[model samples]
Target chain A: MTASTAGTRLAIDASDLVKTYKGGVQAVRGVNLRIPAGTVFGLLGPNGAGKSTLVRMLTTLSAPTGGSASVAGFDIVRQQKQVRRAIGCVAQNSGVDVQATGRENLLLQGRVYGMRGVELNRRADELLLRFGLAEVGNRFVKTYSGGMKRKLDVALGLMHSPQVLFLDEPTTGLDPEARSEMWEQIRELAWDQGLTILLTTHYLEEADQLARNLAIVDQGRIVVEGTPDELKAQLNGDAVSLELAAGSDADTAKSIALEQGGVLSEIGVDGLTLRGRSADGAGAVPALLAALEAADIHVASVTVARPSLDDVYMRYTGRSFNAAEQAAAHAAKEEKK
Target chain B: MSALADTWYMTGRAFRAFLRQPMYVAFTLIQPMIWLLLFGQLFKSVTQLPGFGASNYETYLVPSIVVMSGFFGAGWGGMAILDDLTRGVLDRFLVSPVNRASLILGRLIVQVLSIVIQAIIILLFGAAVGASYHHLVMGVLVLMVATNLLATAIGALSYGLALLVRREESIIAASNFVLMPLQFMSTGFMALVLMPHWMQDITKFNPVNWTLVAGRGALGADPDWGPIFENLGYLAVLMVLCAWVSTRAFRSYQRSM
Candidate 1:
């Protein structure tokens, strides 16, 4: 990776990076990533999947226990100041000083990166205008709404015109409307500014919508890496969902569905709804219905759709994203007991 | 920009935030006035005792109370740092290429500024109540500088404790634990000769006593030049040591991250 020519150096490159905390908790375990210059990359995962820890290491806020990485072609460990100067990071928590005005915060951040006088003032104003915060730029952040505070956080990160911008869960706590607005701002930051962006998100839709290239992280490891469409295409099948009647037997229905010729895997049942994949959903529906009828299991309704990123996750992890999250939470609870 | 410039810029941010809280500043400033008025009158008769050097209680109480204000204000300075740590503002600065010393120093500078303002207010209030300085303007400036040094040193230690514990409750407990004992042991509220023999000996080592003695010499009828300069030097050395400890605590925090 280091042998790349000057013109095409990777914006961010990590090889076998690991981070084990003081109490033996391995937050990030040997994860590797290569993000191209001037592209948007996503790190997608559930709540406890180490996405935030990986960002911390990349941003130079925390040190990795093993291996090495570089940002903008500078070694993260040895040239940390250079790495910091080349990148901007908007962390998961809002980092804006609530008592200070937004413009003051930006000015201070710009100064921290060595900007001063006219250059700093101009950049701070430009960012406020760019993020649609110019009207309230001089008002104290304590008076701003949640969405406005988050916007100020992003604006502060961009105060130095960094080459690589890292947004960790940029829209995690926002409402639906604010989330879409934040998505627009992120897109403009990457597309118009030509900045390389490495975003971490737990929302699959956000990853699919904003990231051109993404890696699905689970349990401190990368489970899958590709463009969202490419990942979805890897599951070369249609998703077939069957809604069973209230008194229907789910085990018998699953066994019946498995007996059909085109059924790809075990049925996934969420309460009365059972789902499976098929090579050709339309053609397999008749045989699937006949098998269920033979077993005298009643089905209320049936529908088929193209495979989504959710299906892609299921195909790789053998469980849905929500189920995996719940199981992880339950296991953690039982461990505490 | 140079490191000094970065520290100044960061200090401006903290100073602006402090200005926004008018009510907080008002309360802190007013509390010292209440102590000076209430305690000065309550102990006015102490000046009539033999071996007391001052002609009036207000003259003697003014300088001590001014030093007390600085001590009290600087003691709780870490609450602001705790707020920054919880809100992620400190981490934002940590990720930047800014000088790490600036982060700690910038905060202490703000506390020193507040202490200076409080000292000035006390000075004005004392003059209104018939307290006159020994050397007038020059002596007033010395008192201000001495108070600033003491506040900066104590504020630095408060920030160090803030980073070490990172819990509001524990920081407050640690602050009171150190402050209450120091207040009882120091010569801030009384003259050295008035204290018991053992306490007078122990007060020789109290950092707060160094601040008070310097302040009293500046405002007394006849200023003692030697002990004032010596104690001011001690305050300067203590300020450097406290700033170093605060920076070390910051390093530990980054490593733990």
Candidate 2:
């Protein structure tokens, strides 16, 4: 179990991790990561960015192609049994057995981890209640709603009270309400249990809300990594938006706005909207107003807001997060075919 | 403490799931019963030939029915593997500290036990219709071992196929395409002498024929130890081969993922 004994702060550490599938599909290409204990670390990436593959490797489902990783101070490859003992994995696919009841699933999982007798039964019941699955614990999982099934999957993963918990796209196919509820549960698990969590998600808002620190991965590599506030602060300005009056010429308005004392960051012709970044939106707004007035462009409304994670992603990638996700998903489907 | 305690824990879950859907159990039992009642009646008069060893047709048919029920039940064992693969349940177990061999062994053990129970029921039905075992205890023991060995081999083979294809439809199609012909070609429904000389020669290599021979040896008035031991040996070898194949299939499935 070649693990770093340098203090106790690091929960998970990886260096130059590489995973290549058959036919030379480089799913994870030389990635490096470090996660602190008791923090919710988010691996932010679009579909096919190798998030699930990395999770699988770390959890010992698959071995890495190159480099090395350690989870909870145990080498992922050399001490796979210890790694398996220390980490709880809630995979992208629902792992619950639909033929078995919720309680049955948890009990089986607990027993697999070497828990038995009274301790196993107590843990199963406790998790059922904690995850809000007590009511349906005796019912077959086939009758469970999608949200309930996913929750039970998480509960099953948590049956052994592992030190590290891995959640791969925990709310990918969930409804909005269910997604929020899942987010809350994830937060509670980290806060209440002090469990180190590693989560992967395509949703920018989900990463922004839950992650204390995150890495943006694209095409099997990390593009950037930092706290959400630190990443957003990299934009270096307040974002100012001007909603032009109906039928206004957006191109002409954008040209006039660019001439003002701020940098024109974006121009949307469809909505006749103009966006600019500046140190002082209050002063820059008047200057932009004067410029637009001189250009004879009517403005319906104007507002300025702080730079968000989306703006930070746009600055780095030159594409909206959602657009990148769509492209990645399309590429994944094509590869499958 | 028990050799079968782990098997029980694992088999208990499968049985619970099986019991949850009573219709599935009914359907599983019905197919074998049809083969016993209908097929047995159709082939009754054929046993009048010399060296048939049984005076009554029911007596000769009972052992075949027991082996056939085991054959049919074991064919569907791979469905459980396919279901687990599709639902991500197998992945969950992979990451846990669960004994991997136990997972496959448990399912095979459950299917074998279920088939044995069904064989007992069929034996009782045969008795009611003028069938009787000369060595009843030894016959029951022989049937138990024969059914268990046959079911385990077939179940493991099916599990291997399930992992190879990783789809329910493919697993079902392959099992059906393979087992139905093998059952018909074996001595499960007829005496070896009743088959053509070429077919009789072919039956020598069929594991199902070995099961039928062993099962019948225990039930017949003239019990034959030589053929019974030979059949048991053949089945033991086949069981090892199928178990190895299934383990390799499981590894390949994990690698693909």
Best by DockQ: 1
**Any runs in candidate 2 off by more than 4 Å, and if so which?**
A1-7, A245-259, A263-273, A280-283, A294-297, A303-305, A332-337, B1-8, B49-53
**Candidate 1 chain A weakest lDDT stretch, 10 residues:** A1-10
Q: Of the true contacts between chains A and B, what fraction does model 1 have?
A: 0.90
Question: What TM-score would every model get versus the actual structure?
Answer: 0.90, 0.93
Q: Against the true structure, what is model 2's DockQ?
A: 0.72
Give the alpha carbon lDDT tens digit for every residue of A13-116 in model 1.
Answer: 99999999999999899999999999999998887889999999999999999989998988899988888888899999999998888898898888788788
* Model 1 chain A, TM-score vs. native: 0.84
Model 2 scores a C-alpha lDDT of 0.84
Measured against the true chain A, the candidates' chain A TM-scores are 0.84, 0.89
Model 2 chain A: ten consecutive residues of lowest lDDT: A1-10
Off by over 4 Å in 1: A1-8, A117-119, A244-260, A263-275, A286-299, A314-320, A323-337
